[model samples]
Target chain A: MSTPVTSNPAQEESTVDHSKIKVSPEEMEAYDQSGRKPVLLGFFIAVVWLLIGTVLGDLSSFKFDRPDLLTEQAYLTFGRIRPAHLNVMVYGWASTAMFSVSLWLMPRLCRTPLRWGNLAVIGILVWTVGLGVGIALLLAGHGDGLEWLELDRQWADPLLVIGAAMVGASVWKTLAARNVHHLYVSIWYVAASYPWFLIIFLAGNMPFYKGVESAAVNWFYAHNALGLWLTTINLGLIYYLLPKIIGRPIYSYWLSLVGFWGLALFYALNGMHHLIGGPLPSWMIATSITASIMMIVPVVAVGINQHMTVVGRFGAMRYSPALTLAVIAAMSYTAVSLQGILTALVSVNRITHFTHWTIAHSHLGLYMFVTLSLFGGMYYILPRVLKKEWPSRRLVRAHILLVGGGMVLYIVALGIGGVLQGLSLLAPGEGFEASVSSAKPWLLLRSVSAVIISAGHLVFAYHAYLLAFTSRNSLTRHPPFYELKPVLVKKRVP
Target chain B: MTRILVLIMGAMATVIFALVILVILPNSMLSDLKAPPQLKQPGQQELLGRQLYISNGCIYCHTQQVRDPVFTTDIHKGLGNRPSVPADYVYDAPHLLGTMRTGPDLFNVGTRLPDRNWHLLHLYQPRALVPWSIMPGFPFLFEHKPTAEAGDKVLDIPKPYAPSEGVVIISKEAEALVAYLISLQHNYPAPDSDALEEVQP
Candidate 1:
């Protein structure tokens, strides 16, 4: 395992297979240097927001069990803090983390140094300030009524829209100046996310759309923000990291085409499923449900392709932090997508809609799938950019266990509590208070789970701090292939 | 060039399509929608209450729309007298048809539960009425004075939730919010609400 792999410059012509197997040292160094500053800044800011969101989430959950806990103060009330928690997690943590990875990956995949690097850094600064201001306003009781778009549009939207555009423009410039001929699948995914994000952010925050229609637009933007922006970028990162780590190409290149196109076509229509049994026309909901069911094609295609790539190399997960989180995230991708499909069905939607069951489903998608995937990608990317190694493998393992275990406890309790609540609401003679009472035990459990999740965030934030600022010489220079079998496996050809 | 086009266009079209279905088409279809027969514009107090509701993020927990009985028993649960319709919300700007039903639907809450005192008490301390409610009491919206003044309306809060040494008085904001809640009554017949067919004998 201590044996160093050699890179012979002339081997690009001497061996056809070897050319594809290794990236040139010069290219690797160039890719590593590109977007280094913005990525680090993003990572730092994302960790800070993550910790804040976790604390807010814990306090909100605690308030559910004991309403009087913070009733003395208006700003700390559950109504304000709950939305504040969501905004912090979604916009502050998820968006910034995705942006950081996308900034690095886009330039690398294009074989070009990031253009307008200064603009990207400034954009991040603006965005971070805007998000903080928006959150503060929300806490101070200036929030809009929309679920995900709670920040006041007049005050907050311009900063976010402009800041995101500046950051995204740099990535597009990098894409336009690509040194490579063939576009990788990951490049396609990353290229698409920035534009999609801008369009939706503007459309959702527009002042004209109102009444019942506003609700429709709200879900349209909210769901697509998750689908096109967060989910797409994470998928792109996985596509890049999985093969890059496991020393192979994607299992089926053709299958990726099917998955990408399927998602692009179907995911938008599926947003209306959130409005099932709503005041909208029946045809609208029916169309959304159909689109939702069609999501299975993409989900299955992507799932099969990703799983088959790592079929025999499950051992790689033991060694690679990136691979471990990516695999768990990949599994969760399938689970959440299928779960979403079922939940969109009319019968299931009847029972689950407006219940905590949907909350569990969303956490499955957001926490389990998107956040875990980003964690994996960051692990792989941060070391390369910083020219250092992780300070502790124990911290990485601890993060995985804590986050994974907390989500399981959280989702399960919410799922059962939601079902019971839904049933109690539906029963002819059951009182509303009875349903409320039944969810208390689960709500208390959720608070405990939040504490566990917060611990995981602290561990990750500290680990990142160590990797970024501590002595570069103190950490290992080589990749920590802790569980690989020293050398490449011999192919057993018949 | 082709690759860039496909990538950009592929992403762009998703939002465009969503806008068509969710925004444009729905707006065009319901563009002529007016207030239902029994609908009236919210008065100054009710509008203030609506703003307070939005500011407080009540929409996070209490949805304002009740689904058809086929999909939910919200009507049977006494959340509303009938299914809510788009026209029922024509006068609303930034409609608050919330997603989660953590508490009961409040579309017809004002009609079904008419006691202003009950709402005031419930808002001040939810557990005073329902022992197991997880809803946080809005203590900030009420003041606990040593005694009620001439014009101050005293609350009849039950024991334990009430303060030991003071009378609970509802603030003006609480009063406006209650006025808005009562104004939410759409129990009147509407073309889309199925109000005529579903009338209780």
Candidate 2:
């Protein structure tokens, strides 16, 4: 390796020339290969948790329509199952997948080998144990009973914090020792997310905030966990993967800055939409509504940047699984955010506040936007880290179609059903029970869609298993479309 | 950007935003809040029932707070008599102001449906009573007795939902849950809330 360039500390400026970083292709490739074991371990764990989460999510949804199906088993009761499903999905699947991507991305971005790969493995193990304990207690009837904060913080939370801290510290250390002078926008997102996670996780689980204040803090924690923790990292992954896959810089660097800062400024206040008609002060709700609407700024900024960059690269999406998923995720991010702003408006909130529309909206953000983007990141990262071709092109195609189909069915059924249920609730003569009954068909359909999605998850898990373990000699293509280049060209809007 | 700028932005958004909006502002505004005359601390039975309610994630389906009619239709729908204020929830230690109304608002469920027997039977098998309630039955909170004991109160569950060979007696947990459900009355108006209502057009 070239002698380690130790420049004077005072020469470091806010903007460093990207060309001066001097990270040779070999160095970059070495960094990518270094994270192989830990990242794959994370993916394996995440897929397994996703399968479990899908089953539980389906069982929980089914109970809403058919309450008598598993009444005998307390563990399978809808109440326990619902929270368990949420925890598993959010903490187990989504978070684990995010960690895997972050670990791989940090090393590449920093132009350094991951400093503590073994620590991340240990952290993942600890987190799995914490999740297991939390889920078991929830099923055994011992949860703390706050939305998103259901896991008993006293016992289970510290383990999570410790696990997260171990992983987070490793990233920080890698960043600190970086030979690169300038940090990318993606680095800004990844670096900022860890602190936000730690702060919110601690504050949300604390016993100090009580009663009405607790409700406020609860939303603060819940919404920010999605926004700051999940949204931040996934957006970072999108920013990284899109440019790398398409072999081009983002359309507008300044717009990316606006998008990142806008998200950092606005997302904390948006959680109060969950409390529009709540017992809090009206001004608080209005402020939150205003912030929620302001989210369009960042959403549009990111949308323009990503879309403009991919303007002429539509054909590249066919070969790159990562680009295809990222494009879908970027589009969903825009759609879901605009939808969020509309739902937060007083007129719409009056009709849809308590209905299934909120559920549909959340899934649009979580499943379509966050989870799908992570899937794309996984597709890109796995082959690079493993140094082998993906075993089956058909499996990846099948996984995408399955998830896309299931998600559409799930969101459409719930969206239409939520509107019908809301209007029925608003209509004076219709009894409340009638609204519940009217929603049964839609809820049943949601359960069916969940099964379809679960099938996609199994296929993904099986494919990942094959890619991780199968020998290199058995693969058809050596590098799996490594010579791919930009195939889409931008056209003038006029 | 400098590392300090990153730190500042994250802090301003996550910590400072929550401090100003969620904690400082709301707490300062509602500092004068006191429970209305009718609202009281939950009794021991009601507390146990509330625990059961929480443990079972009842808050996921049922919301407790009703909104202002000027903004929404909660009043006209008879979900609550007036807009709930912070004072309405002062006695509550852990406020259950749920987000979803998959079931109707339970702020004044006690006043709307107060019959004790109705609650017990309804909890045992919601479909048997309402014929279309999506709520899960709390059979785990009740027990099946071969015959009614000397002091046992047999639930009048409908023919289909009734245990095939035994009398369904309300267990202690069900009794506590019903007691908690019955104690959810918020019909009486607080002075501050009524004044706000009078000011509205």
Candidate 3:
């Protein structure tokens, strides 16, 4: 007979009787695993980045609330840290964690050991330093003053090329040794995103597109880097996890193929919508709008396929964290995407353009949808990759409740704030300052939302900390799977 | 199992989307927007100047629309317009719905910088032009190839070119962007007589 091993280290260490425990050979072998330590260490680093991203976000939000709050400091001003918050969230937190996960998971998925462990380490170091140096350049007032590509031109080129090299090499080796016939959807997305971003990046920021083309090129890069680079990777996670969690085949493999091509073709041309009224040519704007509108095809197709796969899965939403997160992400696809289409239209854009409404829309897409999906994917993947269960259910619940509640408050408040501000500005005879004053209350509400969100993220980092450091032998053993009759989900209609 | 919850959400989205496009947009666009009246095009010289303004990336820093009433308080700041109208942009091939205002919106640039020579001097050195202007000067826009052992100076605006004198003319691309800028006007209502005929016609 064997003693039950505890995966929760905190629980094991706190117990009074160490002599009472007997560890099985399987538990001993899992205990001997060295890969778990680095994964935990990587998580701690990710936590620190999360704190920095949140603080920067909160600090920048304060500038909107109090325009002259610490206005004397040049580096601490709104403009500098605004890009800093974005980069830290985009590059530091999301990119770094995704890199860490891919490096760890790809080898396991391919059933081969990582060839050059040093390359992964080098990649993390280079990627981190690039984010720091680029942000330092931005705060020092050397930024190119373009959104997303706001890093100084001097640092931007090398940073782009070097960072791409690191991620590319690691991903290449992992894919080279494949154990399975089918390359998972996540692999397809993660693989394509690296080269795609690398090409689009060099084209936009090589200091070649100087005059009239620079503005056009900058918008193009800003939209795609987020869309094709980040969003596609997150979507890959949903395709895999949503099916896996429910223990079902995907609703339609053919729909998956259609969604893939539809996204690739439509997303690249969609950037021009951001330049709606900008002096870019009508043909360009019309093409972008058509592309933006055409995006509905992929969104609806993917949405229905995903939905049909999960039909009658409402009970799982109560039990499975991954399913809940993935489902919300799927829902956000429709909301933010439709918002993107409407905003791209010129007449509707007349009010929404240049307003905080765009920022709200951005959050719904980037934070609520994309990042949340990644976080959800992490909940499932991190356990298997590290070969350890979570230390506590309570911390996980705290993370879910806080972040979920916090974002809804944030997204809703900003939308209202933007709409009110937009209406007052459009009001006849109203002066600019007066319209601004009317929107101040909403801006104040937004600041409060930022505070709540930062708190939620802090709680999330804590939960992630517990998950990483805990040993598998310390977890109260769970049944690998409970036998159940599979419920039939509906097939999608043409 | 299926997403019974999200199906309701899916149904809700279709309805909300229908309401927004069909009901919201048409009512707003069809209403009396009371924007400033349409202005005539720049004289060919100014049209040349406006094209010069655009080619140089001036619009990156400057916006043409005061903010929408629903968006900001800037509606009346560029006074004589309520919210800008679709008719105002009828001639604009590439609509310039500029997002930022790093510099002032030039919706009424004609009124703001009416002096012809001022526009020329400003293009040469914007800091000298506005005193408070943060904009960089377009020294390259002016023709200034150096002579042997002599300091560089602008090749004068144009020379009555002959065997006697040497200077290159400014390119038409530069002139076009600037003419577009010089053409911006916030105060030009159609005549009462012209309005009635056009409305009827």
Candidate 4:
């Protein structure tokens, strides 16, 4: 042991093959070639979806600001379009774009190329057709009136099945063509998410759950989609991208695996927490609450892992749009999930459930964590996918500032409004009318934030059009002003 | 070695845990969960109106579950209950708790707006009704095909897609929505004494 002997049992000296460690020129070319196009296409589509979704959202918000904006037109009513806006963002904008990025990222993380590129284009088309029909049906007042499940059953069921079929083929192909062995944590998360959705979504949306039982299932599906599919996949991507870009091993891979299991075990059941103290069974509601509170384990572990990995190396925030949005999303996830656990308490649920307070809680997850994370993912992805940097960094800077400020203002305003509404109605001798009045101001502020978000979306649309429509060389010549400072990754351990 | 049992148990716990979600599928309505409300009487029109509310998706926005005296959250915005009773909906086909207040909870609206004319105007054009309402105008409910402008028709109206124009100043659907709204109250057993009337701060 005293001698540095290679064969000593006590001294477990490790030998690493430098040849395997370094990527050969051929390998580097393969990686760059594989990573570039998909990410560019994914980000561009994401920006377009964001543009349209944000416009619809602003229109709906405008109804609250001046409820007479589109009174004559039935389709544009807040009642009709609120669900439309949500679906557009959920499916058309965020999820689709996320899929594009994930397609590229998943393959890269697994050390493989995308399996069938042509099929992906087919999947996008099929899913788009489904969404277009679904949106038109909703606007036509043929909607089933189920939140998130509003798509008429005729359109919804087939759409989900087809969407799954395309994706199933795509994911399987990617997994089989792997060039590396120890599959990364991001791949694990993304892999677990898809089939889980197929099972849960099919079962939950099954027609056997009719009437109020179906309502319960609707809430269950609505929430689980976010938990199991959207949130999980986004977090998985971040886990891969953050460390790889920063050139650091994740702070603790063990913690990440634990977080995965904890989340998978807890999140699906937490759906019933929304129906606490309602008509649902004591056990059903109680289990939801328990599962929800137990969620702190995953929350803490993942939070610490993501945060610690980025802590010292966060100066990458200046140059990388993905890192900046990703860090914010990480922080928001911790905050939102912590808030989720806190709100699940029965005493708190008494004040929060059935009020705008619940709305406020949900937005923390949707807008802050899911939306921002996906946005960050897009910002990182589109450049590589489109084969050109963004045409204007000013637009990007303006976008971040506008959207971040808008979200904060929007969330805070709605939160304060929701709490007041809950407390006021709960207060002894208070009238329900008073609760309605209290929320009005917050809705008004949210409308303002919606305008801010709209401006940001417009800037984004212009950027996306440049990528999607314009030539790559033209964009390169007109790169955003912020790029001029030559924002490169900041390495600290000199 | 014993700790290993706990480890296997721990990993196995998640699989067993999911079985709980399987049993929760068939759930009870809000009316089933609570005691019957203390209301004394409901008018004939209000009863018929509630049936219309369900078939038309009015219940999608109007939850009927009134908060206890300790809380009146719905009362502030223009809704409330007089302590809901199972009996109030004893004649109901589907008990509407009036969840989803995208418009507003309508439990207490009846007592305040006893006038039938106002509700008619509001339902025809919700802006003509409540200009600031985000509620979609139910132009489809009013009769465009066979226009009637005289009186309420009590029919076994089967087709939900077809609009029913009553032979009166208002449509039967509009009347039904109003009748349902008027049924909403904060005092189920209308307080004989003014002092007993619940007041919000």
Candidate 5:
């Protein structure tokens, strides 16, 4: 390992001081050039999708309070818009953002400039086109009716699969040509996610399954899309960022090993827990519940590893927006994973299964955990690649507070309302309409929260646009400005 | 662990194991499932209605699966006579076993309210039937005629929901949708092997 370790605090500090280590300017420049085009393209596309998806999500949430608001057009109806919003956010925004992060991180970790950069660029463009066309088809009333698989199987899905493959090829090729002897933990996660995603995506979209089997496959794909794909990449990013920003090695390398494998083995079975109390076999649900509970092993391992690493270095977040977002995202991962385990239990699933509570839980995972991590990744990568600091610190602070505060309100409102709605549904005396009435106020609050989140996205989009396009440079370069001037290096060749 | 190939193989093996156990095994075990005698294949119009249901994304709000009566209140709520079974959905291609219940379970909605007129009116304007309903009215599925023609199925929309200048007539799409909704009955007794046993308290 290149980094030194010691038990003595003073000696350790001196040994691990970042400035003492030499880095070749040419190598760093090569890494930046290799990733600049694909990463920037992916980020730009992701921001646009984020804006569009947020609007669609806001409109869908509002429909709960006023169903007649946009009923004039079939395309504008709640059903179409809701799925459109979900797809746009998941595929267009989150996946693209993640791809960009992976593209940037892989080269840096491998100690090699990225290979096939042009192919990665092509992949991003193709994925963007596929998503755009798929959403249009969905709005035009040609959806596949499966939740996450709403994109047309023949027309849109093929392009996505091919596009993702192109990007994956680039990532793998970069990994194969690594200069480093020991692969980082992040490499395992980011690399494994591509194949895992491909397997589940193909398996879920298969047309053969019928009846309860289809539901089984649907959720297996959907939940894994979160666990193996989204969860894996974000966790990998956090593992890298948390330690890097704090200028320390991870707390325990063994804990990371347990966490990574445990996630892969157990998360796939957790999907069946979503169908608890439904028509599926009891044994299937039982296995899933067992697996869901078993997720605690990985969740806690990851939790402790990240927490201990940053315990004394909490002040580092003040200097780095990326660290701030990563810390929060790591916390959300623990919270959402624990909540998921509880919800998987039969008793809890009985209440939250079909209610808005599930929606709240999903947002906590997707928005709080995954999206925030992506934002942090972007904040860190954008400055380095663009050779500029964020245009305005005020905009960064505003983006954080708005999104963070909005999500807290969103989860709380819908969480309580969903529980009450579940109770009402279970009460023999209460009519079904009572359940709807009970959730109405919370649904309205959810709409308000959506608007807040949309505002945050708008702010983030404008800031990103300025950082990428405009030449405005901030006088005060952020800390870790060591990259801009490599004068501290005592010239060393690898 | 440092080798890329080892990492890839290990990851792939774990997911394949999951796929086998969760998907392949369950599918093989349920492969012998036979549709109950009463669960007939949907006719031409009902199939058309099913298409309409899928296209309009009705499955987003409405679930087709009815939960266990003993564990939940699905039976007491009149969603189904018994818990739905694997055999109950043999005809479903991409199963409409929805996740959310923003509206209500529609697995046995056909058996609950079989009245064709009520369904037509409900589709044209949900508030006409249930004042507190948040379901969007499918006005595009109905026509606004100045006067009802002979043999036309006119929706009995109440005031405030009905158009001020014209009569509301159910179009073929609405009729097909209603037909599909009304055909959701699965009250047939599931085979003992496939049936979900209620847990005695």
Candidate 6:
């Protein structure tokens, strides 16, 4: 072990002895080896989906401005392509990426070699095939038609369930054999998400419910998929990555406790807020609205915890690319959650429910918060797993700036435009065309932002390919688990 | 050991709690709802049209629900006769209560614009009727014919939208989709239990 070199008293005060947290190289190697094939396979497939999803997203956004561009083919039509973009991003890119991250995170947190790693590999393969077939069926005009549940229920959804079960089994087995007696907060989140997702997925695809009841179940499943599945897992990643990068423990364990239970309790009820003033019982909508507001408890708890953890270490973000993206994503979690609460209020939902503002809000939550978290996890995980430095630091910087900047522009432009469009619709004297006109210029801006974001995705994808395939084993020694260390600023003797 | 059990069980209990409250309860509560006397189950053609609408992903752009007039201008804006109630949609399977209104609400569209020909032209080329509209034309849903056949419904597309050599004829899919759109009339009186009291402006 290396000696602790302390050059400044101030720095010494803040820096903990990381030696206590460091694992034996052999143990880490065992963990990494167990996860290697599954993680890489999952990541490679995820990148392909990311690129495909980006192209589809760009086409869909462009269609909003110029709907005539791809009218020659039925498959390329805006309606089909729009859902294709959504599914590919949510299930294809985000889901695969999250699964890969979990494969790595679970082993590390459990202090055990991953059990049944082959199951995960098979799971990923099955998932990829299912998603591909599902997207094809959608384009071929055979969708189930529920938003966020458009995949063919009979053929496609069954495969996804089977694939997910295999993956979940592997993770669960690893957790069961964990060396540690106590489970971490991250494990709790990851463990919970599996069952939560299974319940919702099955419920969403069930064929029995008809009419408004189906709509009720649809939103119920859709919102929980976000809250329980995506949000839950990504929040777990944030909890693990934020402190690990900063070389600090989380600011408050109790806050994590509050955040977790608060989310599980509140988020499930928040779905019906989407149908406010629609064809549901007013009491149900009111319950959702109340639950939506109650979400502030979790959001604030998480926000404060993450903020306080990184309070003095803001300078660390300059050196670690992962830190920068993860911190931004952490902040976005708070921003998007707060915005969601406000949007759920009757006064705001009245205007925003059916407009482009809701689109902007979804993007904020999905792209800015969840997708960025996955990217940050990838940046940290790939180097350790592949045992090499990133091929090009410049490419990573380019991706961060392009995607981050584009998201800001996207949310602002579409958010304002959606408000204007909603107001126009509400005005008694204004024609329906006025709402379309009001949204036109902003839709054009959204296309521009999509182009920027797509360029970023391409840069990251190429970098990932180079890292996985072409990069030399330049890292002779194992890279440090955490990238950031306290910089001891020495006092100059007068 | 107990802690792990608590964590897993606690997590699961929350979801079950939500499912019971949000899904199962509402489902049972609304299960007994009967379609109003004025509401009719769509005919076979209209059902086929509904399938086409679903397959084509029309619900992504157009909504079928009309919000309460107190909260929205849905009624004043001529989207529906009354706010949509659970009874208004008893026959719909895989309901089309879409989230976005990129296009106008279609719940009462059959009542709003009853012309079959107009819907056909709009589906073939939306911009033909509404020039500034961003809706995609389902040209693939139509067939180009050198000459019209007997009993064929040929689309009279405007000058800019029309092909120079052939006339546009509606396919079974497009016709069904139009039938579905025309069958979306839910102007029936709301059930007393679900009706909102009129508020003085």
List TM-score (chain A only) for every prediction: 0.93, 0.93, 0.86, 0.89, 0.93, 0.93
**TM-score against native, each model:** 0.93, 0.93, 0.68, 0.79, 0.94, 0.94
- Candidate 5 lDDT over A205-248, as tens digits, reads 88899988888998899999999999999998998899888878
Per-prediction DockQ, in order?
A: 0.52, 0.54, 0.04, 0.12, 0.58, 0.59
> Per-residue lDDT of B99-146 in model 6, one digit per residue for the tens?
888888899999999999999999888898889899988899999899
Once superposed on the true structure, which residue ranges of model 6 sit more than 4 Å away at CA? A1-21, A473-494, B193-201
Off by over 4 Å in 4: A1-45, A472-494, B1-61, B67-118, B125-201
Backbone clash count, each prediction separately: 0, 3, 57, 43, 0, 1
Q: Which residue pairs show backbone clashes in model 2?
A: A312-A488, A312-A489, A313-A488
lDDT of 5 at A322: 89
How many clashing pairs in candidate 2? 3
Q: Per-chain TM-score of chain B, candidate 3?
A: 0.58
What alpha-carbon RMSD in Å does predicted model 4 have with respect to the real structure? 8.3
In candidate 4, what are the lDDT values of residues A208-306, reduced to their tens digit?
453345545766777677887788888887886677666676777668877878987888778777655443445666778889999999999999988
A-chain TM-score, model 3? 0.86
In Å, residue A251's CA in model 2 sits off its true spot by: 1.5
What TM-score results for chain B in every one of the models? 0.88, 0.87, 0.58, 0.55, 0.90, 0.91
Task: List, residue by residue over B43-140, the lDDT tens digit for candidate 1.
Answer: 99999999889888898789898887886888788877778877788878888998888888899888888888888888898888877777888988
Q: Interface Cα RMSD for candidate 6?
A: 4.1
lDDT of 1: 0.83
Candidate number with the higher TM-score (4 or 6): 6
> Which candidate leads in lDDT?
5
Candidate 4 docking: what grade?
A: incorrect
Candidate 2 structure quality by residue, lDDT tens digits, A1-494: 54354354643442233424456768878998877777888888898899899899888888877778797766877888988998998999989888888889888877889888888888888888888888888988888878998997777888889888877877777777766655777788887888888888887888766567778888888998998898889999998888778777777767887898888788877888889877776667777898999998998999998898788976778668788889999888889889999999888888888999989988999999999998998888887787777887778878988998899899999998898889888777887877787787998899889889988988998888888887853555643434443223233222
